[model samples]
Target chain A: MLDSKQMITIKGTKDGLTLFIDDHSSFEAILDELSDKLSEYKPKKDEPVVPVTVKLGDRYLNDRQKKQLNELISAKNCFTIHAFDSNVVHRDEALTWKEESEIRVVNRIVRSGQVLEYVGDLLLVGDVNPGGKVITTGNIFIMGNLLGIAHAGVNGDRDAVIAASYMKPNQLRIADYISRAPDYDSEGVYMECGLIDKEQDKIVIDRLQVLSRKRKDISGFERRMLNG
Target chain B: MGEAIVITSGKGGVGKTTTTANIGTALALMEKKVCLIDTDIGLRNLDVIMGLENRIIYDIVDVIEQRCKLKQALIKDKRFDYLSLLPAAQTSDKAAVTKDGMETIVSELKQEYDYIIIDCPAGIEQGFQNAVTGADKAIVITTPEKSSVRDADRIVGLLENESIDPPKLVINRIRNHMMKNGDMLDIDDIIQILSIDLIGIVVDDDEVIKASNNGEPIALQGNSKASIAYRNIARRMLGETVPLQSLEDEKGMFYKVKKFFGMRT
Candidate 1:
């Protein structure tokens, strides 16, 4: 048994229009009705007709069908198409967006076979365990232990810095230059490594002087001891 | 609840499928509810390895497409009482399942099973993405060869991006003799470069090939070297602190005698 009295609704959106077909109605008849409507409404030379969605009861068109419709609409070169399973709001901006700030992974432990890489600044909040690697096109900051390999300035930025809390990496690199950590253990010495001279530098076990914010209440002798 | 663990390597013929089959069967033998999801799609082989090819009436695509429920597509393992398989679709391509689809399927399966092992397809593409979408952890399989290790490194990189923590490594088809003679890179070399915890090491065994050909994983065979390695891995995955077996233990008496004579073993 077929129902010819069933109604189908078609509406236009920013990108295209949605076509709603009753589940009991014939798909071919619905297409005929749409064509008849298009013939009567004949769009302008620049304006195009696109089918963004086709809903038949609860079973909407699948991705394959949506892509097919998108292709057909693009062939006409009039309007864009965006399809979904349910009602979708029209958006003026492009659906895809590129973020300015790169992805950051903090305090992350990269275990064996685990890699942490990003296109922007990659700040590790924890250790890059042995068997773990961190690669980045920008600067790499490891706030904790860095016993793993790390490659910074992957895009040939020589100014990129590879800083770590412990500053002991099995392998470390900045731009094209590579350096290995001191295999032999050292005593409680804080180190910060970066380019100080014209060439790439690795300052292992070298402490950076911290500028003390002194108070006026401190005496000269006490201030000398504190500053020293 | 079952945790989806994808055994992946970016390179081909690096023993990804072999590792998946062994780990899946080993976990099942340990009385844990397990399911092996073959995300290879058109190149499905987990079914063949598990010997459930003849039992597959519904493929994963059918379930994802809503032609059938998830249960109707699962093929129970004949060897293990608690094991089941969710075979990938052969007729359809890898595009049949999205990352969201995989996440949804794994979430549903996690409630019923103890371990969900995904046999990922080789290469870092859509198939790889689909396999790892819902993985709570990852097991990367690689051989002793340099190229295999390189690809495994990239796979490790991929798992890290997916926010999957503590990816385990299984060095497959290792030849201890070559390693001892310094002709090949040892475990220490790989550990130094890759910097991950070693879960297990499988020696080069003829039994694995024979068992795979017969559609049976060597893990089901007791007393075999590969089976022991698989069991050790299962133990480690269960939070057991099992030490890696020494390579000297695998050497025969004749080799040890030769070593005593300052000769190459």
Candidate 2:
């Protein structure tokens, strides 16, 4: 029978702990093993920091998927993850976490003088009137007209986009960049979206089909610093 | 117990007082005992609109302060046998009206009347709060303007938080031609914004102005199309399903000519 340590190894280093998760097993199974092993494996009694180095041994994960694994490690509240390493090549298809995100739906016209705020992707079935505002940390999906102010990537995520059926918006903001409606596109051509472009310099408004590709590239995983 | 229905339009001058007088008189005409309370306090208007201003001897302040009995404070409207008016104090401010006092008065009135229609004051301050204190339901009035719709939306949020049921919307002063021309907000636009059950839709008519100036509610007159609309609203409030009259009746010059020629539309 294989030993538990061989399946998922944990070693002590001068600075922190080094965790090696076996690649043969599924990520879920690996996570279960890691969680179980980490919870049971306590460090030296007086250790101040719980710095950890995770080696996936040739597995591919985008920033978001890596962030998920990092979150699981942080949930233990015993370690500070320094690095997430895998030898496998990062593929566009390997991006995960979009499936895990919450998509909030509201079926009401966001009227003037009203403010609608959400953390997840907001799907509104109504129009945003001229003095109304919609804000979200994730993407904004409006089934009705976007005639008001909409701010996406409120958490400084350049990837977040605002998509609407009628995109004749008064103002739009993506991450830190802000732009007003141009006179020519006073009435937007078709179903459109506003997103931060490749240069990360400004927000670009385009047909939704062309814009959604940028969304699929990043998915919905957010990466943040892990606290011990 | 009688239900307290507050007629409120968050912004000023959208016809909350006028609607109250009409609905109260209409309800009374239907043989239902109804009382109209001018909870506007210092800024009283219900008494004037109901033409019961001269009959107000003991006002709401006097009843609250024990200077007069609740019965004495109520002015019986001679126009309708079952209709009465609780006039607001011409002198005292909204601070004189307490939630507990209003609640007591409403509970007492509930014993004798079928409906208590409160004419809420403009703005969401003490006057508005005092009017809404004992309301069982709400009727939010709004003009088809951006500001009116905005204020109505805020009031709807407040009512959903405080009132028993989601407040019913009454879109007043809608201009059909402007709506068709895409110049003004329509009933659907206002409803879409407020997202509340629409109780009534009142079109802009000269009759409403004449009715108010004459101290008569259009509903009680039973003459003009506006009066019929108001009566239908009252009937609907009594739990009767009245189909809304569509605005497509007069489309353009061609339709008007046909109607003028007495041809079937």
Candidate 3:
């Protein structure tokens, strides 16, 4: 009952092109159409570089679909994937993040005896008191002090990260990795972030600036696209 | 008209009764007519703490039941001129008092007194409900320990839910050396956890214990640091902004001598 154009549509963006895929179609059928469309938009050697936004609406691509997309993108170096976003975030039963994730932001201080549990990521702009708790299915970002317990990626997603202005929390959990309070003083130290490194299989707490390397890598791409 | 206030804490042994007695006496010393009410009916201690035990002939339950006049139940403070106590009945239970009855009694006293301070029992039971029923404001007491702070947080939430103004906190029994050494929580830590305005902070002093044992309020002591804290709290309650006193400069030769013997700092 569906038309070919309706299943997958690509439009020119300000700096690039955006591909809007109808999430109602089967993954296999959509991926098949997406490849054909990408080939059509393939830029010539002398053509300008254009960033590509793949908006899947509420659905995210599965592992096999992602692999196929990667191969197709590698074969053609014309398109740059700017953002890949979906509306739905999935959580596992045992405190871990799966292939899906969402975000919730709270601006008020979490007082003692208060407990906040979100299904995906949580970004807070206030402090968490000693007896307070913030539990999330994905990463946690605390703009203020985090003196209480924080459990991120509760369903087994090892890639979850937690960052805070004051990261001297009573306890921190990322996926199945749990770390108790480390001997860290809060004098002059303003920023801290934590992540569960898969290779080390242990949680790592580092200066928040460590994330700048990753962010700068992406920013460099934008600069290169603008110049080259 | 008088303002009624309740001193409460969710956990036991956090010094609600002592705070009520000291604050009431301190206010009375400042030429304010204060009436101390004990709402912990079956388990009364304000009378004993104030040393007005023998004078309590007609208890709060007696006045509520109309067995005696309200004036007859109020025991005048023996030493403090402008202070009085409405003692609770040892034989009665918290169910004997109703919210409406307490409101009426407080209103009646408001006509003659400048302040009526209620000493609420420890816990969130009927006693706490009865005590806080007539209060226009509340002062929550807590120690620096984890359990006390946790309970105070819960009580503050309940007070907000009941539409009681966000209660000001009083962190009692803070040992400064321990706080500096990271063994105990400091005032800043407590304030962060409770997330409420701080009314006062009393230091851990032996005078507080001695004064309680003698039924004498530490606020009556001229040189005690705890007394200074209580006086500031009373003045602040009267709409005056009093700056918190720092204990560092006061730690002189006496503190060094005490610390030399490895006395519990």
DockQ of each: 0.07, 0.21, 0.29
Of the candidates numbered 1 and 2, which has the greater lDDT value?
Answer: 2
With a 3 Å backbone cut-off (N, CA, C), the pairs that clash in candidate 1 are A107-A125, A112-B196, A130-B195, A131-B194, A131-B195, A131-B196
Q: Fnat per model, in the order given?
A: 0.11, 0.22, 0.39
Give candidate 2's whole-model lDDT: 0.81
lDDT of 1 by residue, A87-190 (tens): 33223211211110243667656754677778756778866765678888766777776766888777675545566767556677777777776668543224
Ranking by DockQ: 3, 2, 1
Candidate 2 residue pairs in backbone clash: A58-A87
Q: DockQ for model 1? A: 0.07
> Per-residue CA lDDT of candidate 3, range A1-228, in tens?
357457877888696877787889887787677677666764667765567777889886766776676666546777667766566544442123222243567887776677888876788999877677898766789988888889887877566678898867888888888987857654423688888665787888888787776334223223322322
Per-prediction TM-score to the true structure, in the order listed: 0.57, 0.72, 0.66
Per-residue lDDT of candidate 3, residues B1-265 (tens digit):
9989999999999889989999998999899999999998888888888888878789998888899999988998998679989999999866889888898999999999999999999988888888888788999999999899988887886686575677998999888889899788788878876778999998888899899988888888898988998999999998899998785646688889999999976
**Model 1 lDDT, full chain set:** 0.73
Runs in model 1 lying further than 4 Å from the true structure: A1-228, B249-265
* Alpha-carbon deviation at B63 in model 3, angstroms: 5.2
Runs with alpha carbons beyond 4 Å of true place in candidate 2: A1-114, A123-132, A143-148, A165-170, A181-190, A198-200, A222-228, B246-265
DockQ of 2: 0.21
lDDT tens digits, residue span B12-65, model 2:
999898888888888888999999899988888888877777877999999999
Put down candidate 2 lDDT per residue, A86-197, tens digits, no spaces: 6765443333234225577899877666799987578999888776899987789899888889998787877788889888788998888898987773446458888877
Q: Relative to the unseen true structure, what is the C-alpha lDDT of residue B178 in candidate 3, on a scale of 0 to 100?
A: 90
